[model samples]
Target: MAVKLATAMALFAVGITTGCQGMSEQATNADSKLDLAVSQALAEKDFRLYYTTGRRPVVPGFEQLAFKELEAQCGVKAMPGTGDTLRSEADKKARSEAYQYAREFNIKMYEACLNRR
Candidate 1:
Protein backbone atom coordinates (compact mmCIF):
# COMPACT_ATOMS: atom_id res chain seq x y z
CA MET A 1 0.00 0.00 0.00
CA ALA A 2 2.86 2.39 0.82
CA VAL A 3 4.58 1.75 -2.53
CA LYS A 4 1.32 2.31 -4.43
CA LEU A 5 0.68 5.63 -2.69
CA ALA A 6 4.20 6.89 -3.43
CA THR A 7 3.90 5.91 -7.10
CA ALA A 8 0.60 7.79 -7.42
CA MET A 9 2.09 10.88 -5.83
CA ALA A 10 5.08 10.78 -8.16
CA LEU A 11 2.82 10.47 -11.20
CA PHE A 12 0.70 13.39 -10.05
CA ALA A 13 3.77 15.58 -9.68
CA VAL A 14 4.96 14.69 -13.17
CA GLY A 15 1.55 15.49 -14.61
CA ILE A 16 1.52 18.85 -12.91
CA THR A 17 4.94 19.68 -14.30
CA THR A 18 3.89 18.71 -17.80
CA GLY A 19 0.72 20.79 -17.53
CA CYS A 20 2.71 23.83 -16.46
CA GLN A 21 5.09 23.41 -19.38
CA GLY A 22 2.21 23.17 -21.79
CA MET A 23 0.66 26.34 -20.43
CA SER A 24 3.96 28.16 -20.82
CA GLU A 25 4.21 27.04 -24.42
CA GLN A 26 0.68 28.25 -25.10
CA ALA A 27 1.41 31.66 -23.67
CA THR A 28 4.54 31.97 -25.76
CA ASN A 29 2.61 31.12 -28.90
CA ALA A 30 -0.04 33.69 -28.07
CA ASP A 31 2.59 36.35 -27.60
CA SER A 32 4.27 35.51 -30.89
CA LYS A 33 0.97 35.68 -32.74
CA LEU A 34 0.14 39.03 -31.22
CA ASP A 35 3.51 40.40 -32.19
CA LEU A 36 3.15 39.25 -35.76
CA ALA A 37 -0.27 40.83 -36.03
CA VAL A 38 1.06 44.11 -34.73
CA SER A 39 4.03 44.06 -37.08
CA GLN A 40 1.84 43.40 -40.06
CA ALA A 41 -0.50 46.21 -39.07
CA LEU A 42 2.37 48.65 -38.78
CA ALA A 43 3.76 47.66 -42.16
CA GLU A 44 0.36 47.98 -43.80
CA LYS A 45 -0.18 51.42 -42.33
CA ASP A 46 3.17 52.58 -43.69
CA PHE A 47 2.40 51.11 -47.07
CA ARG A 48 -0.95 52.86 -47.24
CA LEU A 49 0.56 56.18 -46.26
CA TYR A 50 3.24 55.88 -48.88
CA TYR A 51 0.84 54.85 -51.59
CA THR A 52 -1.54 57.72 -51.03
CA THR A 53 1.03 60.45 -50.38
CA GLY A 54 3.90 59.27 -52.59
CA ARG A 55 6.19 59.57 -49.58
CA ARG A 56 7.47 57.33 -46.87
CA PRO A 57 5.56 57.31 -43.61
CA VAL A 58 8.72 58.08 -41.69
CA VAL A 59 11.61 60.39 -42.41
CA PRO A 60 13.64 59.52 -45.52
CA GLY A 61 16.71 58.11 -43.84
CA PHE A 62 14.69 56.13 -41.31
CA GLU A 63 12.11 54.46 -43.53
CA GLN A 64 12.03 51.43 -41.31
CA LEU A 65 12.13 53.20 -37.98
CA ALA A 66 8.70 51.96 -36.97
CA PHE A 67 9.73 48.39 -37.69
CA LYS A 68 12.80 48.79 -35.53
CA GLU A 69 10.65 50.17 -32.77
CA LEU A 70 8.38 47.13 -33.06
CA GLU A 71 11.36 44.82 -32.79
CA ALA A 72 12.58 46.64 -29.74
CA GLN A 73 9.18 46.34 -28.09
CA CYS A 74 8.11 42.82 -29.08
CA GLY A 75 11.15 41.02 -30.51
CA VAL A 76 9.37 40.41 -33.85
CA LYS A 77 11.33 41.01 -37.02
CA ALA A 78 9.71 43.20 -39.69
CA MET A 79 8.42 41.46 -42.75
CA PRO A 80 10.49 42.05 -45.88
CA GLY A 81 9.19 43.57 -49.15
CA THR A 82 6.38 45.44 -47.53
CA GLY A 83 5.17 48.13 -50.01
CA ASP A 84 8.02 47.49 -52.42
CA THR A 85 5.85 46.19 -55.21
CA LEU A 86 3.30 48.95 -54.92
CA ARG A 87 5.79 51.62 -55.89
CA SER A 88 6.15 50.72 -59.57
CA GLU A 89 2.51 50.01 -60.37
CA ALA A 90 1.35 52.37 -63.12
CA ASP A 91 -2.40 52.32 -62.65
CA LYS A 92 -3.73 54.93 -60.26
CA LYS A 93 -6.91 52.97 -59.50
CA ALA A 94 -4.89 49.92 -58.61
CA ARG A 95 -2.82 51.98 -56.28
CA SER A 96 -5.94 53.44 -54.72
CA GLU A 97 -7.44 49.98 -54.23
CA ALA A 98 -4.27 48.72 -52.64
CA TYR A 99 -4.27 51.66 -50.29
CA GLN A 100 -7.86 51.01 -49.32
CA TYR A 101 -7.18 47.36 -48.74
CA ALA A 102 -4.24 48.14 -46.54
CA ARG A 103 -6.34 50.56 -44.53
CA GLU A 104 -9.09 48.00 -43.95
CA PHE A 105 -6.66 45.19 -43.21
CA ASN A 106 -4.80 47.31 -40.71
CA ILE A 107 -8.03 48.04 -38.92
CA LYS A 108 -8.82 44.33 -38.62
CA MET A 109 -5.35 43.54 -37.38
CA TYR A 110 -5.58 46.34 -34.85
CA GLU A 111 -8.82 44.92 -33.55
CA ALA A 112 -7.31 41.47 -33.33
CA CYS A 113 -4.36 42.80 -31.39
CA LEU A 114 -6.65 44.56 -28.97
CA ASN A 115 -8.72 41.41 -28.46
CA ARG A 116 -5.60 39.40 -27.78
CA ARG A 117 -4.53 41.87 -25.16
Candidate 2:
Protein backbone atom coordinates (compact mmCIF):
# COMPACT_ATOMS: atom_id res chain seq x y z
CA MET A 1 0.00 0.00 0.00
CA ALA A 2 3.01 2.29 0.45
CA VAL A 3 3.63 2.33 -3.29
CA LYS A 4 -0.01 3.20 -3.96
CA LEU A 5 0.06 5.97 -1.35
CA ALA A 6 3.19 7.49 -2.87
CA THR A 7 1.65 7.43 -6.35
CA ALA A 8 -1.52 9.07 -5.07
CA MET A 9 0.47 11.80 -3.33
CA ALA A 10 2.44 12.46 -6.50
CA LEU A 11 -0.74 12.71 -8.51
CA PHE A 12 -2.21 15.08 -5.97
CA ALA A 13 0.87 17.31 -6.17
CA VAL A 14 0.72 17.38 -9.95
CA GLY A 15 -2.94 18.25 -9.89
CA ILE A 16 -2.40 21.09 -7.45
CA THR A 17 0.41 22.55 -9.54
CA THR A 18 -1.60 22.36 -12.73
CA GLY A 19 -4.63 23.91 -11.10
CA CYS A 20 -2.53 26.77 -9.71
CA GLN A 21 -1.08 27.53 -13.13
CA GLY A 22 -4.53 27.72 -14.67
CA MET A 23 -5.69 29.99 -11.88
CA SER A 24 -2.71 32.29 -12.39
CA GLU A 25 -3.33 32.58 -16.10
CA GLN A 26 -7.00 33.32 -15.54
CA ALA A 27 -6.02 35.99 -13.03
CA THR A 28 -3.73 37.68 -15.54
CA ASN A 29 -6.47 37.79 -18.14
CA ALA A 30 -8.99 39.02 -15.60
CA ASP A 31 -6.70 41.86 -14.54
CA SER A 32 -6.13 43.07 -18.08
CA LYS A 33 -9.83 42.98 -18.82
CA LEU A 34 -10.57 44.77 -15.56
CA ASP A 35 -8.02 47.56 -16.13
CA LEU A 36 -9.26 48.22 -19.62
CA ALA A 37 -12.82 48.19 -18.34
CA VAL A 38 -12.13 50.69 -15.56
CA SER A 39 -10.34 53.06 -17.91
CA GLN A 40 -13.15 52.92 -20.46
CA ALA A 41 -15.80 53.33 -17.81
CA LEU A 42 -14.06 56.40 -16.45
CA ALA A 43 -13.89 58.05 -19.83
CA GLU A 44 -17.49 57.62 -20.95
CA LYS A 45 -20.58 59.05 -19.23
CA ASP A 46 -23.76 57.52 -20.58
CA PHE A 47 -22.77 53.87 -21.02
CA ARG A 48 -26.29 53.11 -22.11
CA LEU A 49 -25.48 54.61 -25.50
CA TYR A 50 -22.09 53.13 -26.24
CA TYR A 51 -21.16 49.87 -28.01
CA THR A 52 -24.52 48.14 -28.15
CA THR A 53 -26.46 51.32 -28.63
CA GLY A 54 -23.61 53.15 -30.39
CA ARG A 55 -24.54 56.57 -28.93
CA ARG A 56 -28.27 55.78 -28.99
CA PRO A 57 -29.93 56.89 -25.79
CA VAL A 58 -31.79 54.51 -23.48
CA VAL A 59 -32.52 53.96 -19.83
CA PRO A 60 -29.65 52.63 -17.77
CA GLY A 61 -29.77 49.33 -15.94
CA PHE A 62 -30.87 49.07 -12.33
CA GLU A 63 -27.36 48.64 -10.97
CA GLN A 64 -26.04 51.38 -13.20
CA LEU A 65 -27.48 54.06 -10.99
CA ALA A 66 -25.32 52.95 -8.08
CA PHE A 67 -22.31 52.83 -10.35
CA LYS A 68 -23.23 56.21 -11.75
CA GLU A 69 -23.07 57.64 -8.28
CA LEU A 70 -19.80 55.87 -7.67
CA GLU A 71 -18.46 57.31 -10.89
CA ALA A 72 -19.55 60.78 -9.89
CA GLN A 73 -17.77 60.40 -6.59
CA CYS A 74 -14.69 59.26 -8.49
CA GLY A 75 -15.51 61.64 -11.35
CA VAL A 76 -15.77 58.76 -13.82
CA LYS A 77 -18.44 57.70 -16.30
CA ALA A 78 -19.35 54.54 -18.20
CA MET A 79 -20.11 54.35 -21.88
CA PRO A 80 -23.86 53.89 -22.18
CA GLY A 81 -24.43 50.40 -23.58
CA THR A 82 -24.65 46.70 -22.89
CA GLY A 83 -23.85 43.50 -24.72
CA ASP A 84 -26.05 40.43 -25.21
CA THR A 85 -24.46 38.85 -22.18
CA LEU A 86 -22.41 40.21 -19.31
CA ARG A 87 -19.68 37.55 -19.30
CA SER A 88 -18.67 37.59 -22.94
CA GLU A 89 -18.59 41.03 -24.55
CA ALA A 90 -15.01 41.21 -25.79
CA ASP A 91 -15.51 38.45 -28.35
CA LYS A 92 -16.08 41.06 -31.06
CA LYS A 93 -14.40 44.41 -31.60
CA ALA A 94 -17.73 46.15 -31.69
CA ARG A 95 -18.71 44.21 -28.60
CA SER A 96 -15.50 44.91 -26.74
CA GLU A 97 -17.02 48.09 -25.44
CA ALA A 98 -19.84 46.03 -24.07
CA TYR A 99 -17.43 43.60 -22.45
CA GLN A 100 -15.64 46.42 -20.70
CA TYR A 101 -18.94 47.68 -19.39
CA ALA A 102 -19.76 44.19 -18.20
CA ARG A 103 -16.70 44.32 -16.02
CA GLU A 104 -18.41 46.99 -13.99
CA PHE A 105 -20.98 44.40 -13.10
CA ASN A 106 -18.17 42.11 -12.09
CA ILE A 107 -16.46 44.82 -10.09
CA LYS A 108 -19.60 45.78 -8.26
CA MET A 109 -20.59 42.20 -7.59
CA TYR A 110 -17.30 40.37 -7.01
CA GLU A 111 -14.53 42.89 -6.34
CA ALA A 112 -16.55 44.76 -3.77
CA CYS A 113 -16.44 41.71 -1.54
CA LEU A 114 -12.66 41.82 -1.51
CA ASN A 115 -12.45 45.41 -0.32
CA ARG A 116 -13.56 44.67 3.22
CA ARG A 117 -10.83 46.96 4.52
Which one wins on TM-score? 2
Tell me the whole-model lDDT of each prediction, alpha carbons only: 0.49, 0.49
**Going through the candidates in order, what is the number of backbone clashes in each?**
0, 8
Residues 1-117 of candidate 1 have per-residue lDDT tens digits of 999999999999999999999999976775676467557756664322221233343222234458445334333322223444454556545655545444444444534444543
lDDT of 2 at 77: 30
Q: How do the residues 7-67 of candidate 2 rate in per-residue lDDT, one tens digit apiece?
A: 9999999999999999999778877876675456445532222213333322233334454
TM-score of each: 0.38, 0.43
Off by over 4 Å in 2: 45-117
